[model samples]
Each structure stands twice: as C-alpha cells, then as structure tokens.
Target: MKLYVIVSLWALVTITHQIKTQDNCVCEFISSEKPFPYDKLKMMQDSASNCNNLMSPQKAFGLESLLLGLNRRLPQLEDDVEMLEKEDDGELYGVLSLYVIENELTEIQAMIDKLNSSTSEHKRLGDDTAQKLEDVKEKMEELETFDAMQVMKKQQANQRLKRDLDQCRNGGLHPRPQPTKHTEGTCPHGRFLNVTGPRVFTTGEYPGSYKYGAWGRDPKPEEGKESWHWLVMLTSSNIYAHYVRFYSTLSSIIVGVSTPGNVLIHPSNPTTNTIQGPNVVLYGGALYYNCYNKDAVCRFNLTTKSITTLQLPKGTRYNSKANFCHLDECYVFTDLDLITDESGVWVVYTTNQDFGNLVLSKVEEEENQLLSLGQTWRTSFPKSSVTNTFMVCGVLYATRYVDKNLEEIFYSFDTTTGKENLNVGIFIDKMSPNILSLNYSPLDQMLYAYCDSKLVSYEVLFEKRSNFYL
Candidate 1:
C-alpha cells in the first residue's frame, strides 16, 4: 500500500510539469510574420492564453526560446507605445486647430456677404436719386425759353469773331512774319553751328549735356538742302527717361524733340521706346536707333510719324552694363550700335556664339518695315576692345578706348572687300579725352564728335583721296 501511494504522487508531479511546459510553448505566436500589438498593454497580459498547442518537446523548447527573446524586447515595445501616444496627441491638436480656423472662416464669409448686401442697397438708392435728378433737369429745360434779343446779339458777336478769324487766316490785319535766323557763326562748309551746352537735363551745371551720348548725320539728306541734319541722344542712369535732340544745319540750337517729334514712343513696350546706345543713324527719312533694354533696332519715320521695330538675330547682346572701355575708364553704354555710311544703314553688335567678335548687318526699309538684308560680316577683334566705331563709305573704322586724349583709329573693316585691318595707326589729335561719339559726315567731309560735353568737328583729309565708292 505504501509503494502504490508514492508512485501515484510521482506520476502527478510529472503530469503537472508537462502541462506547465506546454503552456509556455509560444514559438508559433512569436515567429509570426505580423508583429504583436504591444501598444495595447492590457492585451499583452492575455498573450499567454493565445499560444498554440505544443506538438513535440523539441517544438516546445524552440517556442520557449522565442518567447524568451520576445520578453527581452518588452522595454523597446513600451517605448514604441509612448511614441505612438505622442503622435496621437499631435494629430488631435492639429484637428482642433483646423476646426477653429473653419469657424473663423465661416464668420468672415458671413460678414462679407452682409457688406455686399449693404452695398447693393446703397447702389439702388443712388440710381433712384439719379433718375429723380434727370427728371428735374428735363422739367427745367421744358420751362426755359430762348430770348430773341440775346440770340441776335450772340449772332452779331459770332459774325464779328468769324470776320476776325478770316482776316487773320488771309493775313489781312496781321501779316505773316518770316522765321528769323540767329546766326552766331557759320561752321566750316556752311554747316549749322551750335554753342557748347547741355543737350540733356542734369543736376549740376552741365544740364542738357551730351557728355556720354551719341550723334550722327542724316544718311539721306533732302534734295536742295544746304546743310545736313544730325540727331543727338542723351545718356542717363534712368534708361526710360532718355532725351533726344534734333540738330539741323539750319539751326544753331539743339531742339529737344520727344516721341512723335524726333522718336516714336512705343505704347505698350517701354523697352523699345527709349534709345539707350550712343549710335543713332538717320537713313531714308527715318531715324534708326538701338532700343533701350532690347536686342532690337527701332526705326522712327519722319514722314509717316510712326515707329517700327526690327528683331535682331538670336544671342545678340545689347543694353548691357558692359560697354566700351580703354585705359582711363569704361563708358557704360549700349552693345548694339546703329551706323550709316554712303551705302546705307548697318547694325554693329556682338553675339555670344560669335566668340566676342563683332557682327555687322545691312538694314533696309520696305513697306514701312525695317528689314535686314542678311548681308552680314564678322570683324577680327572683339567688340569690347573697340572704344568707338563708325562707318565711312562702306568701310568701318574703330578707335581705341584708351588714351582718349589721343584718338587712335587702329582698326578698319571694309564691307565691300571683306577685308579687316588692325593697327592702321590713323589718329585724330583734336578729340577730347571724353569722346563719347565719333561720326564721319559724308556730305561735309568732316568728322563730328561729342567730346567732353562739347561738339567738335574735325576735317577729314582722306575723303577725296580714298578709293571708297559711295
């Protein structure tokens, strides 16, 4: 009886140990592809009840190892839950802020609607009041009558005024006076001369001056005209408010001419309205200039009184801060220059693709539109190295920007022969140090220059001897 009781107790102990081992077999649960939800800390307490049944002792041992590994990572899982809770709080705050904003927007919309209704009411009342005023005016007009004596007096006064106007038109009472000529002195070759004064409005003593400006002669002067006409453009920091002066050989004074008078004012495009460069050429009864802040040329017709624009080739640089310079200083002007010679008008400019070389194009007018004839040429030197350039006959002459007191004409390009010569050594000693403009006149055989805010003329000695066929 004692042996039977001891065996029974040992069997019971073995069964209890097996049951406890089976309960801890959680390998299937821990090895799942999906993660266990540790955010729900209450659910984690019931994890043991959700374990799969053990198939073998080895399987149970593997499950026990997996559960041990998972137990070690419980602290990390708790940290994750805390982070999730913080994110939830942030999202909740954002939603609350959005709700508040929506409410404010609703109130603002309601106020706007109310204001609109009030405005409509006021507008209706104003319309009614206007109608009543119109009716009152009509009633007053109906009651008014014309006076015969007053009418007769008005007719007599009108007749007298008409007679006076007719007499004025016929030059009966007032004889038409002829324009008086104020000749200070005559320039050489009967050229109209002007005293040194500012052509543009400036702050200091040099108001209306062309210190850094451009001047050129009319390429096609009118027939039977004794003197040549020249156009001068003033330079300013403000590119839009540029001033132009019309100088004729007939007048000794520089007349300030605005758009529609000297230049055509561009209505919608302000960039094309003003002239920025120091190169204005008069050709075929039209003034050609470099448009301000644009890579195009502007043609202002003197007869038609209109402006036309001609687009230049792509990559042509103009209106840039980089201007011609020499040893003393650099003059900030335009990159594109309009030049006219005995042949016609040509545009001188530089392009990025040309590798800093100068490009020239012959311009022609057809049907009131300016067109390029595609007769283009390339110069040997870069445009930046040239201080000033002008066309004589069909040849282009370039002066050095350095040693302005000693004007050295070092470069020349012949459009006819397609030959470019450098270091020609031709010099003009009479030019000032600040010679912003240099133009050769084919008519007077003279070189006109705007040097140091004064107009100076130099006689061309080579005009008769040159082999140029103008």
Candidate 2:
C-alpha cells in the first residue's frame, strides 16, 4: 500500500508523511526538499522571552495584600523573639512572656498554614521558623524549673548555634611590632583611620560555589611570583581545603580569565596539614593555616614542599570550639586565625583559660628557619562578639557586624602599651554580609577580606605623621 499525507498547521509548522515501497513500505516525511524553518522557531523563543520580561505593577502575585500584613507581621514576630532572647534575665521574665510567645507561636503557625507561596525559599523559611518557634516556646514554658543564670548561659550558647544554622540556610585586631628610632622605619603612620574601596573585588574561578576563603598578595612572596595573588578556599564541608589557587596578577583574578595554578597541601586531602578554616594566610613563600582539627598551626613552604607545626597553649581552642561570630552568622572551625603584618606572621585565637577572649601570638622563624610561637598576649575582648579581626602596625583591630552593609571596628588592643581601646570605631562598607577571613598586607598596605564567597580588598587609610615617639 502507498499513502501520502501533508498537514499545515496555521502560522505554526508543516509536516509531511509519505510511504512508497512494494514489500516493506518506506516512509519519508520532511526532507531536504522542504526543511522546517529553525530560524522561525528561534524567533518565537525570542518573542516568548520578551513577553516574560513584560512588567505590570500588580499586588495579586504576592501574599501580603491577601493576608493583610503577612510580610509586616512575620518580621515582627521574629524581632520579638530576638528581643526577648537578648534580655539578661530572659527566663526571669519568661513566665510572664511565655503567654505572649505562645500566642505569637499560634499566630505564626496560622501564617504558615495560610501561606500559598510556590517559592521553595519561602516555604522552607516558614517551616523552619515554625519548628524553631515551637521549640523556643517549649523552652520558655519550662524556664520556671531552671536557674536564670544557668539558663542564660545555655541560651547564649543555643542562640549562637541557632544563628549559625539560620545562616546556613541563608546566608581586628591589633597591631604590633616593636618600634624603631626612625619613624620611616617603624610606625610611620598614625593609627588606622579608615578603610575605603572594594579597591578590588572578584568571585574568581569558583565564584558562588565557594562560601569560605582567603585571598591576598603574599607580603614576602617568592621571587618571580611576587606579583601573584593566592587564594585558599575552604573547599571541604566549609571546614578544610587542600589546595591554594594562584593568579598571576590582581587584574587576572578580577577578570577571571586566566587559569589559576593550584598547589595541593597534600596529594591526599584531609590528611595531615590540611587547612582547617578560611583564616589561612600566605606570607613569604609559605602558607600558614590551622592544623587539621588540632591546637596547632601548620606552615607549608611552597619552595621546599616542607612543613612546620607550632603548638598553641594547652587550653587553646580548636576544632570549632571557638569561632568568629556576629548576630547573623558564625564562621566555624576558625579556632586558629593566621595573620601577617609588617613584622611577620601572627596567630590570633581564643583559649578556654582566657574564657574565649582573643589571644595573639607571634609566629617567628628561629635561626634554624623553624617556625615557633613567641610573645604571647591576651586581650579583654571576647572573640565571640566580633565578626573578624586584623592587624595594622602592631595594633589589633576588632570589627563587629553593624549590618549586612557595614562592619564597625569598635575595639583595638595595642600589644606594646598593653592598652585596650573600646572606641576604635572605624567602619567598613561591606559588599557582602560577612568577612570570614581578613588580613592586612604591609606589602600593599591593603586589607584583604574574604567576604562570604567574594574576595575584596580595601585601602588602609592612615593618618599622616612625619615622626613617632617609640
């Protein structure tokens, strides 16, 4: 049997089916003689995109108008919970507040039920907030059975973890070096005054994939690589990394056009000497970082492929026991922060004996070229209160998160004078919400901040001074 069929759908597409053969009929549809117009199909796709881009100011697409203040009300409930949580004697007032919280929890549940958002982020936030609200309500109801002080302490810790998790879903330092007689040689500039610019900003090769990292110029870089920029991304579970990425120049990183060279800490990752946090810094020709899950620092020399370890005090915190935190988030496993300054490399950390206050130690290379900790100092500033810390001219500057767009340096600990100033008050205009790793490079006189997943640099503005009294 032989058959022929041709169908033309109006202003759309055409199809032809034909069968011609004796025994086993062969069918030939659209052929080279009359090919489908792929150009027209592409033009239709362009038109569809244009329609998608069309805009109309309409309230029907969102939930607030339908629910009469769903957006306004949800935030209020969250704020109320935070406000109550911050009160020193939270549980002392808990008995009276529990009823109100209970009412709020019920309302929150009702809101969650009423929400018809197809957005996964909205649904997840509602579900998670409802669960946490329920848990917090239970704790508030039971606060009567517990001691207020003990409950406060526990709540502080719980609040830290809660902020930590919510951030998982969402999301200083001092100076020091000894002074010399000549102002040009030592402490030439006055105290750190201000910071400006993203002087440089880039996502690099990995971009949004990496949320924790550090990037900067190695102050005393190896001969030819002096112009190179180094990046240490905490590539494993946000806890560790085994390689350092190298870019030839700053522009190369910003443009993200060049292939970066990688130097592996170990051929096998999570083995000995793997970097534990984003606080690692490259100084000279060596990379200094926290020893994996240990109260120690590891220096991996790039030229020699050799390593050196410096043990911290017995009570020193490691393995996420102490971390850099702000109201919004905590950078975990940051127990040991390696920093570099004009003098040399330094380690900023906290210890149990110090009650979680910042401890600074100088990392020195002895005559034998071995690294060791020297000149131990302690500061009254609590580590948990700060979002990050860095050093400039032997002065430790500490920053607390003011908001997503701002970080305020409200504290400075001068190692030489053993003086603490709570009014340093220098503010950084941030491009991202968090600065996980921060260090100052005397080589460039710039501050490098690994802000969330982005690498940003700031010019360290100093007060001009001709001479200084050592």
Candidate 3:
C-alpha cells in the first residue's frame, strides 16, 4: 500500500509542471508578435531622462505615465496567467482574452499615427494662409499713400493759378482792339471770301454759302416743323461786326429784331454792343449767349420776343485777351462759352472762386426764361489758353494753341468722374482760321466750327459709344 501511494504523488507533481509550461508558451507567442516595439520603451526612458529639461512639461508627463502604466500592466498579466494555470478550467479563457486585447492595441496605435500626420499637414496650411494675409495688408497701405500724394499735388497747382488770375485782372494783360465803325445791313453773299488751305482741300471745302446763323436739329421738333433750322445773324459792320439782324430760318429777311424792350445794351459800350463771344447755342426754341463782359448769361426767347439775363459769380473774367493765341492771331475777349449737348445748354467759364480753373454750370430755365443754375463741376484745366472746347456726354474736350493745320484734341475733363486726362493723341484733321468756335451736333453726329468767316463740318469717330452724349 505504501509503494502505490508514493507513485500517485509523483504523477500529480508532473501534471502541475506541464500546465505552468503551457501558460509560459502562450505569453511568449504574444510578446513575439507585439504591436508596439519593445525598444520604443527604452527610447522613451532616454527622452525623459530629465523631466525638468522637457520642452512641454504636460506632454512629457503624459508619455511617462503611459510607459510606466504599460510596464506595470504587462507584469500583472503574466502573474495572472501563472495563477490561472494552477486552476483546471481558467487557463483556456485567460488566453482567449489576451488575444482580443492584443488586436485592440494594434488598432489604437494605427489611429494615433494617422492623427499625428493630419495635425502636421493642417499646421503647414495655416502658416501659409497667415503669410498671404500679411502681404495683402502691405499692398493696400502703399496704394493709400500714393492717392494722398496726388491730392497734395492738385492743391498746389490750384494755388499757383490764383496768383496768375490776380495778375490778369489788375490790368497786367494787353487790351483788345476798339471798334472803328458800325453799319446796319445784311452782308451780301460772296462778300466774306473763303480762304482755302490743305486742311480744307483734303476734307472737302466749306459749304458754298456762309450760313451766318445758329444751325442745329431740334431734339424735339414741333409738328410740321423742319428737323433742321438755321437762324441767320446779319452783322452791322462789314469788318469786326456785331450781330444786329436776327433772320428767321423760314425767310431770308430778319426776324426777332432787338427793339428797346428786348435788347440789353452793354453798360460800357453801345455802338458795337453784342454778345461777348461768337458761340451761340439754340435749345428749347431759345438762344443762349455769353453776355458777361463781367457776370451775366443772356437768353433770347424766339416766340415771346423777350430777353432774360442770369447772373454769374463775382470776379468772372470776360474782357481778357484771348487765352489761346496762335502764330497769326489771338482770340479776343473769350471768357465764357455756351455749349449744348444731349442734356441741354451749359456755360463753360472761369471764376476767381475756382482759382481760374474751368467751371461748367448747367443752364436751368423755366417757361423760356432763365431760372437758376444746375450742378456745377470744376475742371483742372486752366481757362486761360484753351483754343476751343466742346462737350460730349458731359465730358469736356479742349484743343490747344498749336498749329491750326495740326491741331489736336489733347485734353479732356469728365464731369461725372471728376477726372482729367492729358496727352490725348486725337488729331483734328480739318480746321480753318484757328477754329474760333466749336460745336458738336448730336443729331447729325458731326463737329461744326466757325473757322475765320466760314462754317465747316467734320465727322467724329469714337472708340466707345455712350447714350448720355447723343
């Protein structure tokens, strides 16, 4: 009986040893297929050798806690497996649980790597965006500085013009010629001869007859009224004459004669009293003329046989010598010019208030009588030396005092934008006698000029078309 009991005890001990060996085998397999490298733990140890020297204290603490927790948990798992091996049924369940934990750990590590890569790309993009914003800010600041400088330059130029106008007003300029004789009659045809030149030859000569009149098509004509009309002006003197005979377009005989009730004789001179400038515009069945040897604009009603005068600003220069002079002649007493466009009549003149710069005022009238002035715009062009000017769509174009044959439309001022353009290369192809007066007819789309003693016309070509002008 003793010999059999000794043999039983030895077999039990051998079974227990085999179970412990089986548990160890399972642990070894897991460690060999580790999701996280064992050497990474050693690298972490070296990186956190001095906690005080870490750049981010919070991040370093987190890494240290993770590594220490992993080290402690791995040893606890081994101990638990050893203890389970001693039981009859617990060994199989513990091994299956460890396999699931290993898969979960592998998935977590992959997610961490992906998150880190995304964070790095986003940071790079943010930095680029910030740099672009800074560059744009700098460019905007530069543009503002340039605009301020331009304003300063414009102010200085205006100051200089004021000083020059003062000199002109104080008898520093030459006086114009005085009239020699005054005669009242119609000038016979062919009395005022037409002088031909290259400009006239190339563009066809002037019309056979000098239609001494205000000629234009009415914007809104009356029923049965002709679309085109001409109001002829018969001069009192053969040379240096004043318009005394107002002839109707319907007949060659005079009409709307300036009786005492309608004629506003000049305060200073009466023998040769007339509108100061040659430019006369017909609008709304009325005649608009510049009368200010000082401060007045005159309007004559064709139907009512009455005259109205509108007062302009003080210190308006009227009798100054020609602002624009050529090699042969200087236009005399050209201070105010009347211009008509699609909108209506406008007075182009200069004033002391504007520092001698060109001022454009829209004519306001009611019931064929002068009422008030509309909106006014100031141009940078000095009113002194403008040879001739015309309006197209509220934009003012001026010719220089260059050679009459080679005149150019070199300056422009836009009323809407308040912008001025210089050095424009539009050449005036055909002009005669220095273009004493200029007008653009929207109806016929032609430019009309009173050159010397003749009326000439030219076709206008524009790069862009605007409805505001026509």
- Which wins on lDDT, candidate 2 or candidate 3? 2
In the order shown, the candidates' Cα RMSDs to the true structure are 42.4, 27.3, 43.3
Model 1 residue 90 distance off true place after TM-score fit, in angstroms:
99
When 1 and 3 are scored with TM-score, the better candidate is 1
lDDT against the true structure, per candidate, is 0.55, 0.72, 0.52
TM-score of 3: 0.47
Candidates in order, TM-scores: namely: 0.50, 0.60, 0.47
lDDT of 3: 0.52
lDDT of 1 by residue, 73-120 (tens): 344345545555565556776566555445434433433453455456
lDDT of 3 by residue, 1-470 (tens): 69989896654444322225634642221122214344644544453443223332223332332333334334545654565565436477767656644543443343345335544654664566456446544654444354534775688689889868876776565332222221121222111111112111111122433322333444434454333343323232211223323321211111111111222233333232245556666666666776545467777665664668887777676665324445565566556777776677888888877777888888888775555788988887787657778776666777776664556676777676677777554555443546667776555455666655444445554433332222
